[model samples]
Target: MNKIKNIGIGLLAVVALSMGSCSKDFLDEELTTKYSTEYFETAEGLEALTVSLYGNIRWHFGYEWAYGITLYGTDEFTNANDLTNEMWNTYDSRLGPIGATTSTGAANGNATSPNALWNEMYYGIASCNTIIANADKIDDEDVRNRCLAHAYFLRGYNYYRLTAQYGGVVLQTEPASGVVRNFTRSTEEECWAQVISDLRNAYDYFEGEVYTYGKGITWTKATAAHFLAKALLFRASERCDDWNSSYKQSDLEEAIDACSYAITARGGKLTDNYSDLYANWTGVDCDIEQLDEILMAAGHNADSSTSGRFGNRTYNYFTPQFSNFSGSWVKRGVWIGGMDFQRCRPTEYSYEVYDHVNDARMWKTFKTVYGVNNVADATAGIEAGDPGIVMILNTKDDHTYDSYTFGASKQAPNWTDDAGRLPEWTVGSRQTETSGSLTAETGQWVPNSLVLYQNGEYVASSFTSQPICNFFAGINKTDDGSRTAEKGDAHRDVTMARLAETFLVRAECYVRLGNYSSAMADINVVRARAEWKSGENRSYYSDGSQAFENNSLNTGSSAEKYIYSNLNMNTYYLSNPDLEVTTEASSLELTSFPSVLPDEDEAIMTAIGASSDYERALNFILDERSRELLGEWQRWETLSRTGTLITRAKAFNAEAAPNITAGKHELRPIPQTFIDGLLNDDGSNLTEAQKEAWQNPGY
Candidate 1:
C-alpha cells in the first residue's frame, strides 16, 4: 500500500490502500494485510486506523454519490441529454435494483452496485470497529477515548446514511473475521437504534469536554448531535413509512431537543456571506471546523488522481457551458474548466425559488453573468451606455431565430479589471420557468450565439436553447487540461453541513411541532442574514412595480421591449474609470432585481395559494434550503424525507417528471451482488426467495 499523508486542513486525511477484489476475500485481505489488528492498539497504529476511516471509504460521498445520486432525480435539477445517469433523473426501470449494476456501468449513472455506497460505509465501519475493539489496550486515556470517538462517529454516520436510504442493512458491529463472514439484514428499527447508540456513546465519551477542533474535518460532539438530530427528525417525518412506531409527538420532541442542543451547544455559526461557502475551498480555511457554523464536511485536497488521491468531484460536474465566451468575458473559471457538459440543469421550478430582485443568495448560489475583463477585448465601438452592458441575453424561442430579449444585468461595471479578473456582469433573460406562457415568452436563438452591439448591449442570436446545466455557481478552476464534464477534478472543498441548515432543520421541526412563532424566529435569522441591505438591491423599472415579469409584460417588440432590470450595487455601472462620471440613476434601465419578500414571499406563495403559516412555513423552509443548499448535495434526500419526492419531482424536474413513481423510487434497491452473495446458515448459497427477502419492495 502507498503512504497516505495526513492533511490537517479540514480533517481530510486521504487513505491509501491496495485495490482488492469485490468478494469476501477482498474484505479479508484489507482487514488482515500489512497492518494487523495489533497495529491498531499502538499509538501510530491507532492514529493510522482513525485516519483510514476518513480515506477512500469517504470517496463515495466526495465524488459521485453526492453529485450523481444525492443531487439529481429531484425537483431542482433535470438531467442533461445523454447524461447516461439519465436513468436516475428519469427513474428508468432498466437501471439496477438490488443487484450488481447493470451493464451500463454506473448503478444509476454513477458507479457500481448498491453495495458500492454500502461497501464504502461498511469498509469504514470495519476499520472503526477494529479501533473500538483495541482502544482498551491504549496507554493514554484521552487518546483512547478520542480514537473511540472517531470510530463511533464514523460508524454511526454511515449506519444512519444506510438506514435512511435502504430501509435496513447487514449491521456489522464487530470487525470482519475471515474470508467467510456471516451477516444478516437488520430491521430499520434496529439500524437506527444502533446509529443512535453509537452517536450517544461518542458524545458521551467526552461529556462536558470543551469542544476542541483540529485542521481536517474532525468528528466532534456537535457533529454527532448534528447528524443524530437529523436522523431523529427524518424518522419523525411523514416519509419514514412502515416505521417501527407511531409516536410522532415524542419522536419529534426528541428530534427538536437534539436540534436545539446541536444549534446552541455545538458552537458553530453561519458564515457571513453565502458565496464565501464555496470560495477558497480545499482546506483553504484551516479552522473551518473550529468555526461554530460548520460542524462537518467531506474533506478533500488539491490532489485529483483517479487512483486514490482525494478531490471534490462535484465542483466539476455542476459547472455549465460558458467556454465559448471569447471577447471581454471577465472572471468565470468554473465555466471554462472544460466542455459545458451539462450534467444536471435546473428545472423551471428551481429558477422560481429565488427572489432574484432582492435575495443575494440567488447570485451567490449561481453565476448569472460574466463581465468584460479586458478593455482591449471589449467589442470595438462598444459604448459605456450599451443597452445590455451588464445583463444576460437569450433568444426568445417565441419569436424568430434572430429575435432576442435583453435581461437587466445583475452586476454593475463597478469594479476595476485587476489583471483581467474583475469588472463583469450578466443579465437575466435566461432561466427555466415552466408557466407555458413564460416558456413561450423567453428562449435563446439557435446556433447559440450572443449578440453585442456598438453600444455594448448583449443579446442572443440563435433559435436553439442552450443546455440547462449551462449556469453553475462554483468557479474554482481546475487544471486546464482536466476539463471533461464527467470528470471535473476541481480541487475545492464545498460545505456539507453548516449552521444555516441546522436553523432550517430546527424550523422544520418547529413547524411539525406546531411552534409557528418559534419556527418563524428560526427562519427569520437565516432571512435576516440574507436580507437586502439598502444598496445591494438593484431595481430597473421607472414603472415602480415590485414584480419583474418576463418579455410578456411588454406590449410590443419595440426598442423598449426588454429594458426593465436592476442591480443592488450603487456604482454597478463603473466598469472603467471613465464610466464613473455617469450617474447611477442614468443606468436605471440596467437593473431589475431588488425587492424584499418580507411577507414570506407572499406574492408568489399566495399566487400558488400557500396561505396558511403552516403551509407557507414549509414552503419557506423548502425554498430556504434550496437557496442555501442547492448543488451542494442533499436535494433528493430532503424531498424523499419529506414525502414530497413525486409531487416535487413531477413539478420541477422535466426529464424525471414523466417517469418518477413514489412506490419504489423513494428507496433505491439494494445492490443485487450483495443479495446473490448472501449465504444460508449452513454455508450454502441462499435461494432466490431468500435473496428476495433481503431486497426492498418492488425492486
Candidate 2:
C-alpha cells in the first residue's frame, strides 16, 4: 500500500492507471499519453479511475483481514482440524492491542491494518474522497453522473463494512489533502446518516437508466438498492438500540421498500439449481460465471498476474486440511479447493443446520464425496510392472465373468459377500476412512454410522449421507492427472451480493418489525428452492418434490429409523464400520432427528415452544441463513447487528463461547496505535484515557 501521505492530484491520476481493471481478461494496455492532473480532468480519466476503484478496494474485501476477521469465529465456523487462528476463534484479545504494531512492517504491507481494519479502511476512504471531491471534472453529462455514482457507492460500501465490524467509525467526507492527524470517532447515528446519504446519492444516480454496469462485475443500481436496504436494516436493528439513536419509523418502511425494489428491478433472481451458485472452480475447469443469482462479485482470473488486485486467500484458509507434510496433494492451477490449509472449518452446528435428505443445498454446498486415488495402484499387484487387474474372480453366483478393471469400468465386484473381506472392485466413488486411505469405513474420517430398524428388530444401520468434508470442498488435487492445482489456486469471481442473501436480509427485517408471517413467507421462498427429490425434472425455478418428510411421524414411536450421520457426533469417529455387513437406507425410512415436526426433535429443538418471541424468531432466521448461505462471509455481521452475537456464539460457536462477553465483542476494538496517533479538534495529542473513552463500550 502507499504510505499514509496526502491524496495528491498527480498520485490519484497514477492510481487510476496503475491499478488498471478487474475484468476476466488482463489489463494489457500501456498508457500512450503523458497525462497529469489536467489531462485526468476528462470523461475518460474519471471512467478509468472508477474502474480502478474495483481493483483497489477489492484488496480490502477479498483478502485476509479485510474479510476473514469478520468471517471466522462466528456461529457457522471455527478453526478446522488444524489450530489456525486459535486466538481469534477463542475470542482472545490478541484480536486487538495484544499485537498492535505501529511499524509499516506490522502488517503484510499491501493494505496495512496494524490493528484490525483501521489502516486498511482509511486507505480506501482516502481514494474514494479523491474521486468524490473532483467528480465534476468530467465534461460529459452521463460520465459525470456515473463517476460520482461509483465513488459514492464504493464509499458507502466501505463504510457499511466498517460500521458492521467496528461500529460508528471515523467518517471522513473530504479528501485527505495532507498528513491528517486529527481523528474523531463518529456516533453510530452520525455514521449511519453519512452511510445513508452516500448510498442515497448513488441510488439516485442510477434511477431508471439502462443498466450498463461496470463490466458486468461491479455494482449498479441493483447493488446500491440492496446495500441501502441492508444499511437501513442494521440501523433499525439492535445496533441502533443505543444512546443518541436515530432509528426512525421509516427505517423499516424504507428498508422494506428498498429491498422490494432491488428484488423487482434487479435481474439477479435465484438460479434454478442450488449447485449453480457455487460453480467457482475456474481452476478445476468448471469456468461458468454467475448471472442469475449473483448481483456483484470481485472478479478474478486463473492467470495469477492480477490476483493481488483480487485474490481470495480465505478460499485456502477455509478449506479442509488436505495436504500431508510433503505437500503432495496439489499443483498450482488444477485443484478447485486447497492444500491442508484448515484455517476455518464448519462447527458441528453448521453441519446440523441442514436437512440433508430434503435439502439439495447440503449436497451442493459441501464436497461430500471424492474420487478415491488408489495411489498404490488402481489394481494392486499382479504379473507385470503395472499392478494388473484380475480378469476373473473365483465365482459369486457360481458364475465366471471377466473383471474388466485396468481402466474406468462400472462392472460390479465378483467377490462373494465374505464376512471378513473388504468389498473389492475398481469402481465408482464410495465412502473411505480418509481422503485416499484404503478403508471402507467412513467413521475413521467422518462419523459414518446409521440408526435403523431391521426386518424385525432395532438393529445395526449401514451408512448413507455422511459428511465427508466440512463447509465447502477442501482439495481434490491428488497429482494424478494433467489437471492438478494448489490451495486458492483458482481465480474465479468471488460473490459478494446475491438475491438469496437479500431475501434473508428482508426476512430479518420482517422479524424485527414483528411481522412474523411475512418473515416466514420470505424464508419459505428460499427453502422451497432448496428442497429437491430424486427423479424430478430439472427445469427452471422448479422445487422438486420433498424427498424427506414426516412419513410416519403420526405413529410417534422408535419403531421407525432415525436419520443418523456424523452430524450427530461432536468429534471425528475414530474407528471404521464393519463393512462386512451393511444395510441400505432404501430398506428403511429417514426422518429428521429430534424431529422438529415430531417428538424426536426434543433433544436439539428444546426451545421450540418455550423460547421467548424474540428468541424463536431470531433463531429461525439465523438457522435459515446458516442453511442457505453457509460460508458466504455474512454471518458475523448478521449476528452482531442483531445483538444476538453473544447468545448465538455461546450456543453454536464452541471456540468463541468461553471468551466472548455481552458488550466488548459486539464491536471490534479500534487499534490503540491508531488511537494514540490521533489529535483532538484543537490539534492536541489525545491521551490514553481520552482515547479509551472514545473507543467502543468495553475494550
**What C-alpha lDDT values do all the predictions have?**
0.51, 0.51
Q: 459-516, model 1: which lDDT tens digit per residue?
A: 2211122332233322222212222223545333345677788888888988887787
Give the poorly placed runs of model 2, Cα more than 4 Å off: 1-40, 98-116, 208-215, 243-248, 280-288, 303-305, 325-333, 374-489, 533-610, 680-684
By TM-score, the best candidate is 2
Query: At residue 137, what lDDT does model 1 achieve?
Result: 75
Q: Which 10 consecutive positions of candidate 1 have the poorest summed lDDT?
A: 1-10
Instruction: List, residue by residue over 1-699, the lDDT tens digit for candidate 2.
Output: 001211133345435443543443323343333555444456666566565566655564444563356666687777554433455566665556434233422222332242645655555565567677778777677777877887898888888878888877778788654455345677777788888889888998865534443234456787888899988888888767864244645787788887787887755357766655662232322323436466667665544544553454545554443322111211122212333355565654665565533455654454332221123222322111111111111111211112211112111111112221222422212222222122233222111111112232221111111212222332221111111233333344556888888887887778777777777667766876776644432111110001112112212221111111111111011111222221212111122211132222222245334265656666667777877777766788888887877776787676688899887888877767666666665566666667677667767
Compared with the true structure, the alpha-carbon lDDT of candidate 2 equals 0.51
